[model samples]
Target: MVHHRPRTRERCPLWARRARASTPLRTLLLGLLLTLAAGPISMGATDGGGIGGTGITGFGPIQGFGSIFVNAREYFLRADTRITVDGRAAGRRALHVGDMVVVRGTADPARTTGWADVVQVRHPLVGRVDAVSAGGAHLTVLGQGVRIPAGVPVVGGDGHTVALHAGDWVAVSALANARDEWIATRVALRYPAGSVPAGVPAVIEGRVASVGPNGVLRIGTQAVRLEGAAAHKSAPAPGARIRVVGRYRDGVILASRLAPARPALGGPGRYVEMEGYAVPRAAGGLHSNGILLRPPGGKEGAGPTGIRADRALVFTGRIGPDGSLEIERMEPPHAPELPHAGAGGGERGFGGHGTHGIERPELERPRIERPELEQPRIERPEIGRPRIERPEIVRPEIEIPQAQRPEIPEVEMPGH
Candidate 1:
């Protein structure tokens, strides 16, 4: 029976024992408090927003290159923001003016200014080349300078580098640089820059080059044939800048209606601004509202209004030689297309559908059948008074009582 007694609970001071047990918990709580004192981990946020936070969004045409402008405000690009054009990944410099864009970003405290976290280009500019540099590093379109950096994708009808030239119409996809210059990423030719396709009506703006063997109006070697067209029964004088709408064939565009070009007119150092609907890319190449812009002095080669010698060639008339005038401040064509006329719509030409050209809506008359009228009828409820019947009552005979009253009455009557 030499079993050792069960070991009793250890005899220790209460506070000391409790402290020993809580050592781990106190250390953990102290570490947690220290962590709480430290602030959140930092990431770059120039406009005071985190990468995961809700951001602002906007939709409009790109107002400039380098930085995107939408809804009349400018947004600079961010490093982590996604940029896409026609569903393709693109850099900030790949954005171009007049290309419709949707942007998401975080606004600064003012909200007027902000940084763009994402941008998407919906459409590219389709137009004719105003000018091209000798080395092909730069070109002009609708008075806007486009820098063709290396690695740019240039696709011709034959597929790749079709040897760009002045007077050639082209469709450009580009981005903006830090300098705000349009850095073209894709220069696709719908046709030879200046030549129009056969059998399609288009609006053209240029000087009449010459008249050919048949009745033809030449717009810089691009002839104008007066066949199957309207309002062109008469011939336009040579060297006249006119807006002609008709089908194009064999470098000749059949003139339907020829009118004097209403260019944004200006003299040297003068500013001109014109706003109009963007013509279809399929028909009108870089001819915004059928406007033809010549050089400042009305001469293209001798213009001294561009930034570079070649860049100078882009500004319509004589404003190009020295490249002095910077008139190609493109505005966004962000007006939405309306379901009905004049509600809210895309660029409507002067005096017509918010879109381009002379279009007449078809009139239709609706035939409605008249419904027949029903005869009037009055309805009344039948109400009549109810009749009640009464029951007859009979009394028992009283002969003796009646006789006694008669005797007394007779005696009194005799005495009277």
Candidate 2:
């Protein structure tokens, strides 16, 4: 069988100026050269290179070389030596499958099978797209601009149309053109859904059925609390309508403004219609916790906040003995009988005992008794007795002598 001889290896010239060229172009040239140089050397080879005398075929494993195969003529490769494909210099040509190649080596004559060393193979140029620019459709390939042709389809991350303007990010793929730019075959955009709705502020409306210790409102299947200092007026009654303005989260709605249905009136025990979930109390009664009931027509009120009732609303089947009203069933509001005292005249107010008014009697004073005193009389002695005592008196005598003397004198005178 006739065989073509393998060519000798040739040295390639290397220069620093080649390395300084743009990155993409340099890579392309390097790949092309390698492909051409290796292509022909692989094609011209006739048999496996000669470690053994057996002829190498496409079937089974070939020995002594990295790879081997049979061509139309006799075995071409006989020994191990580096060679080139076609007439291209070694290390300067690109190689690929099905390209003509030639290998040069010492042929073994004594062996019954022909063999030669595989030195190279041939290759062809394939196009590729590298990168896209910011806010521009132009692409950089092999370090050059590649304008994208029109009518090329652009897809998003979800494989839909890439509807975006400038500054939107995307990925692109295409064919490389003469100017080193890629002719975009496809483009894809990426973004997130569920972003905040534009222009409209969030508003909620519902009835305030119950007020928590922290001032959260129990609406239908939702709890409305305030995040900031909310201007809250009289609380909405169990059946009264309310409007709220604030943020919504999880099953809880936060209120920035809590306003009752009517601004003109305020009192206790008002009935407000509300929708919410019935939370069973641990002590055996049902308490409605979170209620989500929005007002009609979505109108703004005096700083009122609430939840929408369009979604699911939960109700507890029975009200417990703890004075908490349980939802037996959820239906449109009807005329409800006001709670009153029972037939036995039981207490009227919620959880209040019966009423019976009667005054108590006054205390009496104590009485004391005194003992009587007797009078004593003494007897007087009766006696009438005359006892006379004689009086004793002593008289003096004097006048007889004087009379005698006077008579004597008269007689003497008469005598004279």
Candidate 3:
């Protein structure tokens, strides 16, 4: 679940690795010892075979058995690749499609495919913060519930762990326990109002228009590049649904994960779209235009501040339990008078406010890699990381000289 108020597109992804054991007792004992030596053990769970390779980590839905598509890159699994469910060892066959997973591995130089040692069931959500509990332990995004344990990295656009308020967009990966409750990690925040974000985190769900060789494709107006060996080797034609997890930097979305998408219907609900100066309570101090225009059965909060106020900004999302429109997505500003739209009014009670931006006639899309794929090179998992044994520590014995021991012998003679 991803929510956005306004601004941006596309991003990148990095991943992690895994290892398994044929010896169950060895695996367990190693895990226990490592836990005692280290700390709490989490996914990729029990800690054995932590030798060599790049420690790549990423989170998203599983594309298939052979890969975990994270953002634009794919993480390939090796014969020794390991699997874990909430920190416990698992069989490779334990996972399925549509199940969200967080992968840790070592990536190749090409930045596409690499060896993954660990994969776990942990779904991530990127969306507006509908509400936060008093202590901030529990929060809601769109409508999905999330629990933030201690030390979870909560970042803001300016790169700080500022207090999260309602309507702030965030991207967080979560693990569900036996009770199906969510535990969050890798939490990121949207750039604050009026600040240019260095890295824009995003999740895109749409149909792939084309899949070039080397795992690149076009989705909506954005170009997505994939990395991994043997992942969706066949080209993706138009209408091949895909879901992307990545960051939007410069203009490209470097994917960290990828998965197939099934058509979903938003059940019967009241929806609204708005374009205006999303004046929040703080930005304008109380003069802000918060909740500008809400219908009787609708809810309204300030639109995301990421959008420039100089133009017509549009926001669309569903209403949450608190009656606030949990913004699910935003778009680049467009002309006011679209087909079926009015001069200053709206078709479905949406109100277009403020004059359009004065600057440019068109915002150019970023040039992205649309190259053909090379036959993916599948290297052995232990390619770069070698199992070098640690040298043992030894101490040499020192002999005491007779002269040095003489003073103690003389004192002993006096005592005798």
Candidate 4:
């Protein structure tokens, strides 16, 4: 009787054997990695693409000036770049460091710098200084209360801080707090108490309190008569923020222009950078002004995670269809750089135009570019890890002779 010898199973290779044991787990981990990588991109997060073609709009304080820096990025101003300050045409000489501005332009892929097509600076409060506190820390303008905290600069046309007194025709650059209170960034003396320049248009921004027939709009205690094209157009709805530009006569503003105070940055799918303070949200994520910012997944708050809620930050992201900003990255804003006096006699300081000693009002023009001054470096504090200590483990001693120990068989366990 001939019987075939039993064939033994061939041993698999070491690498193959190990891979076989964890194949399912590895596949699961790979799938998780892919999902995480695609989260932001799928949510319309910009990869910083479209260097010259993509439009970028941002709102932030002017950090410095080569052309101008906003939201930590330098924006190169053009010769015809339309600039407006409080609904009036302005030049680069009108821009100041630390002034909050809105820039609409196109940036490179890195988003570090770009070309500015339009720059707008809007002062929240522009009217006669109603009352100044005894300590000069608080004031009221146009019935709106304003608070001046320590270190908040009160700048004049000469770039020096001036004492604020009652009945001064001043313009206040400020940010409204959550309580709708104005916190002054800077108080500018536009004109002396009774020396306001004639032909300087009177501008006021406020919510529309009421509307009357024949193009009459009331804001607070002030009444505005919208004329010309502004009157012919549809009147702004009540509660809408409106900016009126015209002259004041008999306690009423004869408005030649009426526009929205805060214009929307861009439409859906537009990339935008915004700088604002973070406030915790009830649902999740954080709130900057009225803009909602969330991480890629929207599962958690994007801020207070390596970011302080009290501090301001520049958020880089895209505008969602619902007007929310899906935050892709965020960084602390660059500190405001104070302009230094140039060495020449006629040359102005670094912030404004340097006319080289000639004083001509007609010659005053917007600066397309300027030499970049050395800005003081800001060093970040280093974080160190704490050392951990583990308790020592001591084994009990059992004196046993090695030769008298019992023999045990070795067992090979299969990999899981």
Candidate 5:
């Protein structure tokens, strides 16, 4: 027979000969090693994860322009990208650096670059300044207390860093600490870059404290009037956060636009990444940027202990079907250092959001002591000068001719 004999191990390739000589366990181990080497590649393609993956959403301050950067991801704004400011449709020009924004988009598997589908800029507080602290480091606006940490950029209508004052209408972009105190990142005056424009509307965003049946909604201490709104259809319930854009007249705002506030986290099932101060909830889990976070394997209503409140944290997760965040991974906490007074100027004002590294200064209040003193007893001068009896001098009266009194006209100032 001309059939070739089975190939002998000696004549076979070196790889075949070695495979024939290897034990079953060694062969299994070799196959496992190869699979492990290629695992990342196959997994990356299927799950869009593992070394490289898509970025779905992010929330943070806009780091720079060109294409908005948030949470360390650059989201390029395309022609169809929808942009909004304070719940009103706006152009990209309305966006500025240091503005806290939520970006929703699709990123390449590498996660280096992304295309933004929606960019929303929502200010934390927008209302008339109720009060400014003595040093301008703290303010009360629309019934909410705001702290202007040193180095936080305070800008005026002219777009320059300036001191905030009482009664000044402002838009505040900020972060909420665990104490529910707002730490302002940017405070911009809303009036008069030099002069107030006619019919310009003011914007207010806050939780609706109460909703009246008479079409009046109160957010903080300010009342909003919704004209032509159905009781159940357009009115937001109490405790619902919302944005109102309108003119402020008397003590009520005539809302021209009203809508539910956009949250930092996007729709359900959306993958999201955000950097924010974590505030543990009373019920359970952690809350950040308006989203509740439940750690992996955590059961509902079962709180995670040892969670630090107001500690800045970067979280990666997906939005649950109920809108809560399902945390897949949480990085170590990163707290933003409290700003201290810089050496540049004695007066602290908004410094243009430069984000200079500042050390937290020792906040010791120096004690001042006042020396108690006794009032000196001074005896009334006994020598009251004898009142010289001055003889009453007769006064002469004169009559003047009347030129017809010129009529003064009352001028009415223009109303806003």
Candidate 6:
């Protein structure tokens, strides 16, 4: 059973001004006192857990009191140590073994564990992936209630399902029993790309020109295909700029629905690299963005701060009209080196780069050429434990005379 909730936001008040007013002398004195006595501060949840609170905006586990959690929908501040700590801790903190936390915020129906302002982070799992099918080449994780397809959009580490090939290692969270199968709401691959940004699946606002009979919409010169039943109802007038959730499919984008036009951050000519799976190439050698990159193991509704690309490459151009990236260049990463062959033959003919003719000795020759050491000898039993008997020590009969011994000399100190 999945419970859907509304999103929340984070708010920061006049705490900045108060900190700025305090001078170095006062700050130093305060620091000294804090060092001597460690106790919780009583400020709002935006001042770094000081007398005020702290902002939990970035990654990593956050520690401290009075934390603030923010996202697109809303902001929230709670007294709970985990909530007050940071966003990353929401899972570990809110979802303890048996703790129950109530959440009130906007819910994303499409994804399980999607991002929310997180009014509350409590025990048990929240969210779900509606349908599961086998022909989609998807893998049904019997433990997490998730059916991750072969080429789903994912952000590595951020906790989203990335493209999966045979033998790929992945981490699964919130495994539940759904029928006879185990379902995982969160599925992540072991190898993930770097950080992804917030508000990705970012809104690309543009004009809507034509809606074909097939429900393919055109914005400017670009044409977009829509999925689900929402496509037909969301059609817009030709040349009408609109915004749509750029749900990517196979490297290319198919706009889900029409939305109001809005300004977008990170524009054309900005050199950026996004890692995702590569959908099969289209008729014109173009491929769809099939990457399911997120932070290594991200949940749904979470901002995409990372990605897992099927093929790693650099995107030098702007995002195209269809929401597909216009790739200026593609680069495949170099593979690791293999073990070498014998001396000359190994270095020269490795990777099929060089050819060694008949002059060089073949590698098939026996490793040991000399047969003299091959003959085995009879074994001899050891006396006791193979002890090495030392030769008898011979002592000289005469001892050294006292007169022959050198006399000792004493040196005096400066004071003496």
Candidate 5 at 138: error in angstroms?
Answer: 1.6
lDDT string for model 2 (1-416, tens) is: 99989997565575345357788888888888898888754433233334433222111001112123212112343233355532234532222112223332322323323444443432111111234555445644222243444434455444445544433333343222212223443444432223322321223333446776666666533466765657345456565445455544443556666554221111222112222222333333222322212222222221112312222122212222322223333442111111231333222111121211111112234565655656566677777787899888778876765444344443445655
lDDT of 3 by residue, 1-416 (tens): 89977986545421112334356856686778778889764433222113333344444334233344433345667778778743358876555433446565665323445566667654345545668895877877644567766644466544456777776676665443323234554355654433536555555555466667667777645666664532444556776555566655555566766765421112233333322334334333111112332323433433344544432234444444544445555554233222232344211111122221111122356899989989989887665866999999899899987664444543445555
TM per model?
0.28, 0.17, 0.25, 0.58, 0.62, 0.21
In candidate 2, which residue ranges exceed 4 Å CA deviation? 1-193, 196-201, 227-232, 261-416
Worst 10 residues of 3 by lDDT: 348-357
- By lDDT: ranked, best first: 4, 5, 1, 3, 2, 6
Q: Could you give candidate 1's per-residue lDDT for residues 1-416 as a string of tens digits?
A: 79999989888954446565467887886687777789765554444334532245544444333355554445767678798764569876555444446676665433344567778764333445667895877887544567765545466654445667886666665433223245453566666744644464444555567866567656654556666544335677776656566655554556666666443233343322333332222222222323333333444323122222111111211223332333344433332222232443333111121221111222356788899999789888798878878877788887775445444443455655
Model 4, span 291-362: residue lDDT tens = 777765564455436666545567788877667787888876544222352444321111122222212133
Q: Model 3 scores what on Cα lDDT?
A: 0.48
List, residue by residue over 1-416, the lDDT tens digit for candidate 5. 69987975458743455554558867787788788888653534222122334548877666555466565555778798999987689997777656878887776534545678889887877767888995988988777788876766687655567877777778888767666677776787886332444445667667788988678889877888886443335688787767677776765777777776546566777888776667666676667766777865567754445646645556778888777778877664222222342434221122222353232233457899999999999888677667788799989998898889899998888992
lDDT of each: 0.49, 0.35, 0.48, 0.68, 0.67, 0.33
Candidate 1: worst-modelled 10 consecutive residues by lDDT: 309-318
User: lDDT tens string, model 6, 1-416?
Assistant: 99888776555553333455558866786787776688665444321222222211111011111222211111234344334111235433232111112232222222111122333321111111223356423443211234332222233343333555433333332211212122222344443222222222312334466778777776534445766645756467775545455443332236554554421213332222332223232222222222122222333323222323233232223344333445544333211112232233211101111111111121354587765666678798776866698999999699777767688999888986
Best of the two (3, 4) by TM-score:
4
List, in order, the clash count of every candidate structure: 35, 69, 46, 0, 1, 77
Sequence-dependent TM-score of model 3: 0.25
Clashes of 1: 35
Query: How large an RMSD does model 6 have?
Result: 30.1
Best by lDDT: 4
Candidate 1: C-alpha lDDT: 0.49
What's the C-alpha lDDT at position 324 in model 6? 42
* Candidate achieving higher lDDT, 3 or 6: 3
